[model samples]
Each structure stands twice: as C-alpha cells, then as structure tokens.
Target: HFGIVRFPQKKNIVFQELNYQYSFSDWIQWSMKIDSDQKTKEEYDKKIILFPEKKQIRQVDEPWFDMLLHKATIIGGEGRLGRNNVIFTLSLAYYSSGYALETCEYNMIEFNERLHEPLSSAELSKIVRSAYSGNYEAASREFIVELCQEWVAPELKNKDLFIQRKGWWKFKKPREQRKYSHKKEWKEDLVAYLSEKSYISKPYLTLSKKDLASELGMPKRTLDKVLKELKEEHKVFYKVTRGRNGGMVIASVKALFGTIIQVRKEMQQAYVAAITEKFGLTGSFVLNTFKQLAAPYKQPEEVRLFTVDTG
Candidate 1:
C-alpha cells in the first residue's frame, strides 16, 4: 500500500494532487519528536515502540510537527478527490476516517483531465472488499482510530467474523506429526548475521554475488552496496575467486606469520581485555597500542572496532 520515498521535496511536488489522510511531514516528524499532548504521550508509551531517531520529547507548546508540515506542497481551491484529503510527500498515503467525499466520474475529468477517466482509490477498495469477507472489509474501517483517527494502524484494522486457524498452525501440524524438533528461522538482520561466525564457519565465503543476493533476498545492486560498506568497515571482503566471473564474500580475517585473527566488533572488548591483562596495559595505552597495530585501518569515529594483532 505504500513505499519509502527519496527526495521529499520532489515527491511532494509529484503527489501534489493526490488525497491522503496524513502528510509525509507528520510521519517523519513523529519519528523525530514525540506528541505534545499528555494523554497521547502516555498512550504512545504504552505501545512499547521506540523511535531511535527521536531527538526530543515535545513540550506542550512546541511546533515540531508544524515545522515539518510547512515544508510540504499542497494543492488549493477545488478538484480534489474529497474534502480534507491531504497528500503525503515522503510517506504512505491514506484517506481520512469515514471520509465519504466521493469524486464523481463526471467530476473527475473536471478536476484533472490529466488523470483521464478512472476509478478512484476509494472505488478500488470497494471493489477489492467484494472478494474478501464482509467481516474483514468493513466500511469506514477505524482500528486504532482513536490514535489520530486519521492515522489508524493498518494491522489493527483487520477483523475476522468467525474463528479461524493461523496459517502457520497448519504448517506446524505436519512437522509435529513427523516428530520434527528443529527449525531454523531466516531473519534479515545484517548485524546479527555478521557477528555469529563459528571457528570453521564462513557461510557466505564461497557464495557468488548472485547466490548471496538470492539467499539474502536482496537485489544484486543493493547487495553490492552493502558488501562495499561491510568491506570498508573491515567486517567482510569481496574477493574474486579464480575461474569465476562473480566474486565471493569473505569475513575480514587477518593472517600473519602463522597466526590468524578475525577483526570484529564482537571480538573487540575481549581483545582489549586480554591485552590489558597480559601486557599490563590500561586506558589510552591500550587504545594507542591497538591503533598502532590496526593502523592503515583508521578508526572511523565511534564505529571502528579493534582486535589484537598476531604480529
């Protein structure tokens, strides 16, 4: 139903004529600042969701949301799908709660001849509801409607008229009958994936670029970008294998003189502690020595990780 957008200013201009329940600015601002309303803030806290980008909690008189709202483009006069229907610039678009302002087929042309004759999103929703159960496709859907009735959550809007089984339950039944006791979950966590290598385990070490992307369910283009970042961070390396067109990804392991050491964030503290105890090093002396050993690999601000050199 929605896609992330780049270049908010450009997107605002592109969707200037569409109807939306919440503006893009509001969505982005909420992530940056909490609500000013006391009751609203209390309810938001109850949800247990944390916004990492949040810089400050809003004071009652703050204008944080308005600051973002004013940056967006808006259409004026008439010719809109319905009344009070604003558009999103860099966020998902949705209609207002129980908004019944229907643009007539005849009136749509009058509004925008550029659009040509077509059914509006509202009309399309009605058509889609016909295929699904009435319990699910209820009109004027308002789950989480109280949380800015205009900004009701998508998942909360779901409804079932009768009892039903979750899709996974059926899958589990067959596995249980077979006495299956093991399952491996596929999570798309990049950090967790990179940090969990065993002594002899280098899963992606031999995977070709294409196969790696398929396993990660990532696009080849995106995979290339991620690999580049990982390589720069000394986390992984992309080395071309002999007799192959596509290269493979290898964990950044430093081998010197008959000894090997893997440089990873997970190993950093342990490496530091060991050196501190063995050589009686402490404080800046430890950091300075680590830096000397890990030179040519500059500490990229607080992001850089270090390991004891095998020398």
Candidate 2:
C-alpha cells in the first residue's frame, strides 16, 4: 500500500475486523467446531460416591470457543467443517442442509447429531429436509427459539424470555490482540540485525529500500536515517560501480580484510543493512590483503573486478 504523501491523506490500508457482523450460518459453522483439545480439570462433582470430598481430575475441556469468529456466507463453505458443532444447532441445522455429507449421511442426522439433547427423529427429518433444499432462512427464528426451549431442562424452561435468544455465544465486545513496541526498541532491533548480518566493523552489502524496508517491517525514511548516520562515522562506504553489469555494495577497506572475506564466505550474497559511506580500498594493508585473495584470480571479463594501482 502506497502512503499518501501530500495531496491526499493515507486512509486505513489494512482491513478493520470490527465491521463484520455474523449471520446465522456463521454462528452455526463456528459452533460445529471439533472438540479436539483436552486437558485435565478437577471439579467437585458432589454426586461422586467414590470421592465426594476429593477433587477429580480428568481430560475434559473443549477449545471450541477459541476458534476464529469470522462470518461464513457461502452455503457450501458453511457446511464443510472436518467435524465440530460449534455455535448451536439451529444455525448448524441451517448450514447442515447445504452440506451434502451432513444431509446425505442419514435422513436428518446432520443437524440432529450436533445437539446435546436430540429432538424427535421423525419430526426433525421432515423439517430439516425442506431447509436442505434451499429453505434455510425460511425456517423462521421462532423455530430456532422453540428448538432451544425443547432441548433445555424442564426446570430451566421457566426462563422463556431468555430462551428467545438463539445460539450459545454471549454478547461481549471482541478484543483485538496488539503487540506494543517503542521506537527505541525498533531501532535497536534493526541495528542489531544489520550489525550481526554485516559482521559489524567489516560491513558489506545492503538491500533496496522497497525490499528491505518491507522485509524489516520498517519505513524507508527511517532506514535512510540509520544508514546515513553510519556513513557520517566513516566506518563504512556505499559504492556504486558503472556500466551495464554495475551495481552497489556497502563496504570499507577501513574494516579488517580477513573479516570482510569471512563475511562473503559465510553470509548471504545480499546483506540486510542500514549503513552507508563513500567506499573503496584506500588503506595499503586492507588493499593489499584483498589484492592477495584476488591474486591468481584474474578479473573476469563479464564482471568488473577491483582496479589495482600497481604503481
């Protein structure tokens, strides 16, 4: 996404997840998530004759509620879970109608199987069939509310007003996970990474602003600032050669020749750096060391090698 520099303001380029409102099918698909996750839990079951006073621990917990809360609109996509009845049956039934596997398995098992308490097999079969044949929405909210009422216990049925609500999910504001970092921290991480990759004092190689900035999750201007700072120190150099095969490499003869040589051998061809300077082998010792390595290795015609002033 290109930033709006002058003429226009940069509107939010990333998708804001809060805009989404879940539908009945969305509720159903999420509800039907498989309960694979299990861990030991110790709860006091007063009715336990063997250990009424003691806590009992066993693998018994469902991770269904932890699933992603995205709305599913596709009739086919809604019904294609590996297996898990996540939200509630009314929604599950609506989606199951579209699922060939769910509908085709038994007369009315798709929706009925997901229920904690099953309804009448005969009555449910006929009703669900109509929904399967493209009448899912037609299966009114009243039917869903009634289904909830039927499944609940006789004592709890007194809360008829509460039963009016559909599905298992409660109305709570969603929370978005955010990672916090200070500018100082970001600069530190970038410096450390670049230093580690370039072998510090013997710096070599760097990437294009567009590519490296994006890879490092940083702004190009910030990268430029860091690199410019290093260049002013005269510890490194950003050199660009001429001709068709020419390109840029950030290096310095001020750095140890052995260190620079070792980096080329161990590190990647292109380094992730934010340092720059005016570059060349100026020091006699640093220059001769590189010349030694390049000796018996004549410059390739296709690729321009260093200029050695023998005089």
Q: What is residue 100's positional error in candidate 1, in angstroms?
A: 60
TM-score of each predicted structure versus truth: 0.23, 0.23
lDDT of 1 by residue, 110-139 (tens): 332232233355533332222122222221
Report the lDDT tens digits of candidate 2 across residue range 1-311.
12354443347344545567688777666655422221112233434445234332111111111111122221111112111221223333434434453533362354345444444565344334433444333223333333333333223332332223333434543322335444455556555555556654446654555555676677778767755665554434555566666655654423433354344433422222222123553454334444543321221123322332111
Against the reference, the lDDT scores of all candidates come to 0.36, 0.39
What is the Å distance of residue 24 in model 1 from its true position?
Answer: 42
**Candidate 1 Cα errors over 4 Å, as ranges:** 1-188, 197-204, 252-311
Find the number of clashing residue pairs for candidate 2: 11
What local lDDT does model 1 show for residue 16? 64
TM-score for candidate 2: 0.23
How many steric overlaps are in each model, in order? Answer: 2, 11
C-alpha positional error of residue 307 in candidate 2 after TM-score superposition, expressed in Å: 27
